[model samples]
Structure formats: C-alpha cells, structure tokens
Target: MVNYALGNNVITQIGLLVHDIEKTSRAYADFFGVDKPQWFWTDEAEKAKTEHRGKPTEARAKLAFFNMGSLQLELIEPDRNPSTWRESLDSNGEGFHHIAFVIEGMKEKISLLEAGGMPLLQKGEYTGGRYAYMDTFKDLKLLIELLEKDR
Candidate 1:
C-alpha cells in the first residue's frame, strides 16, 4: 500500500481552466441536464490575502461549482493576473487544472509536499477556509490543491 503525503487519497474536487467560464459553465450545465450554477468572483487580494510564487498578488478568478456526487467540478476563468490559474491557462491553454483534497494541517502538508519536490505555487484564503496549489504537474500530470477548512 502506498501512503500519501496529503494524509488521504480522496480527491474532493476537480478544477478546470477555461477562457470563458460563462460559456463553459453553461455548456456543462446543458450537457449534464442541470441548471447553470451561479458563478462568482474570488475575494480580492485584501480579503483573500492571495499570494503567488511567494509574493502577494491581486489575482482573482471567476468561479462556478457543480456538485457531482462526492466530488465537485470547478470551472475557473482567471483574470489577467499572475495566479496559478492564469499561468496554467496561458502556458497550457484551457483544460484540466488541479485535483483538490480537504486537508487538516495546511503548513505541515505544504512542507511535506515541498520537501518532496512538489513546491507550493499559490495560496489564498476564502470565506471559511484556505487553499494552496502545489506544483505537482511534472510527476502527477496535474496540480494538486490542498483545501483546509476552518473548524
């Protein structure tokens, strides 16, 4: 059995990068026969305390979520800022971005992943939790997002 670094192997969410979240989200809703979920912008830098590559950034993205059973599908349309989302969209074109896991010890998990060569790419705060994006693409073929919800 292989022990995972982020504590568990369960993926809670799958994120996709898109040029037009409005159009892409509508298409997904249509394809899935569900109503188009409402989209919202991420918190601004002041509120989110967003950082990219270890520096503070004002990066933000429009996001929409679709609950697909146990996993959520996230559509991200990033602004013209330096975020993991923007970087991936620009470098790789619009497509799959990351898979997220709900974690407990954010700092410890980040340290472990970074020590293992998967350095932290970006991180930010949300309403009830914080999230960090790890640069795991080279080995995992996709970025890994660690979501730590406040208790």
Candidate 2:
C-alpha cells in the first residue's frame, strides 16, 4: 500500500494562494496566536529560476511563512507574473494552492511521480534547497509540491 521507495508522505508545508497576503497573514497570526510572519519578496536578489506551464519564466511572488511545529503555513501573494500561484488564483481564486512534502531522494521521487503521469509544473530554489510543483490536481485533486531541504 505504502510505496516507501517513492518517499514518505509527510506534508511539511501547506501553501495558500491569497489575493492580499497582509490581511491573510494577520488573520492567520491572530487565529493561531502567533506573531505575524515575515514577508519575503522572491525578486530581491536575482530572479529565481523557474518555469510555468511549459516555458521558462521569471514569475515572482511575496511569501509569508508561519511555523507550526514541523508543519509550515505559506501564504503566497503572486505578483503580475506567470507563476503557478497566479494561475491557480485565476483558475480557482483565493484558496489552497499546493501541499508540500519535504523528503530526500527527490530525483527518484520526481521520477516516480512523473511515471505516474504527474508532470512537473513549476520549480525554483532558495537558500540551499529546491522545490518542484507537480500537476497532479486532475487525479489527486490537489497540486503536490516536492521539497528537498539542504538545511
């Protein structure tokens, strides 16, 4: 039942696409009794190497993160770019975007997921890690994000 070779099913982050991050972040912070999450713009340094749909893109977004034990809540305010966040917002409006699983052996996992017909939709790296979004909404009913952490 559980294919361990494909990696563990641990969802470390729940990403949400929001129309207004400041309000959402404040709401979540108050609801969870936590301080407001620090926001980061993806375009501070060099543009993140990413792809949307099937073409290379420079899509950007402002992100706010809140840690809940081992799990994290990510609020994404997409900029005027062709990123997945923007696309998801356009198609579904403000709501869940992707569930991320942090695990090892990402190449193998990516291969396994790809073999299952889930094509890679977007990808970008930060710090010493990388993440990839898979187009699995049709079958899985939700987008899946695979994160490989180096720290």
Candidate 3:
C-alpha cells in the first residue's frame, strides 16, 4: 500500500483524477461492486475553507466517492483550471492522483510536512471539513492529501 499517515492512522482514501467523474465513478463502483457513489462539487461559495499555494484559488471539481470496507475511492472531474486536479490530468492523464488520511491537528501536520520539504500544492474545504494536498509524489509516488473534519 502507499505509505503515508495522518496523526497515527494510515492513509484511508484512494483518490484519482478523471476526465469524467460520473462515468469513471460508476465504472469503478461497478468494477468494485460497491454501493452508489456520493457526489459533491467544489464550486459552491462559502465552501469549508481553502487555499492554493498559500493563496485563494477558485479551483473547482466534481467528485464522486465510494466506500469499500476501510477505504474511500474518489474520482475527480476537473471543473476549473489553476487547480491540482487539472494539473495532474493535464500532465499525467487519468489515473491515480493522491491518497488521503483524515486526522486531527491538520494545520500542524501540514506545517511539519511543509517544513520537511513537502510543499503544499493545493487545499480546499468541504461541507464540514478542510483538506490540504501535499506534493509528496516524488517520495511516495503519489500526492498526499491531509483531511481534517470538524464534526
């Protein structure tokens, strides 16, 4: 498995970049025999809280999620440019993007990782949570997304 962590827990989500979220998500769910996927968009105003490279970016995407036992598989369809998803898709095509771990003390963890040379590539908010994506692809072969939920 891709080795990364949040606090003490292992990475728990498998994220992917996709050209078509609904199609890819349904295909993945069907292939994995999982339940229907949950959907979300990143375009809504007053979204959780977000920053891209230490600045606010209007990056957006359509996302679909599937729960398979202990991991959530995510498919992202890029809806805006100047975002990580777009970059990944543009550079690498459709495939694995990042793996995530939801944990406490998110900002602190991000700081530690950033201080250690892993730059913060992208960050954004969801309904009740926030997330930061660290550029760990060189070391881990995949981006690392750190999630912090306030519920």
lDDT of 3: 0.79
Clashing pairs in 1: none
What order do you get sorting by lDDT, best first? 1, 2, 3
Best by TM-score: 1
RMSD of each: 1.5, 2.2, 3.2
lDDT of each: 0.93, 0.84, 0.79
User: How far off is residue 79 in model 2, in Å?
Assistant: 0.8
lDDT of 1 by residue, 30-95 (tens): 999999999999999999999999999999999999999999999999999899999989999998
lDDT of 3 at 80: 66
Q: Report the C-alpha lDDT of model 3 over 1-151, residue by residue, as the tens digit.
A: 4223456567689888898877787787778777667778875535635566777767788888887778887888886657788888999999998988878887788877877778899887777788889998767677888888887
TM-score of each: 0.96, 0.89, 0.87
Model 2: per-residue lDDT, tens digit, 1-151? 3343546677889999999999999999999998998888875325457777768777888899999998998999998778788988998999899999887877787777778788888887777787889888878899999889885
Candidate 2 Cα outliers beyond 4 Å, as residue runs: 1-4, 43-47
Pairs that collide in candidate 3 are none
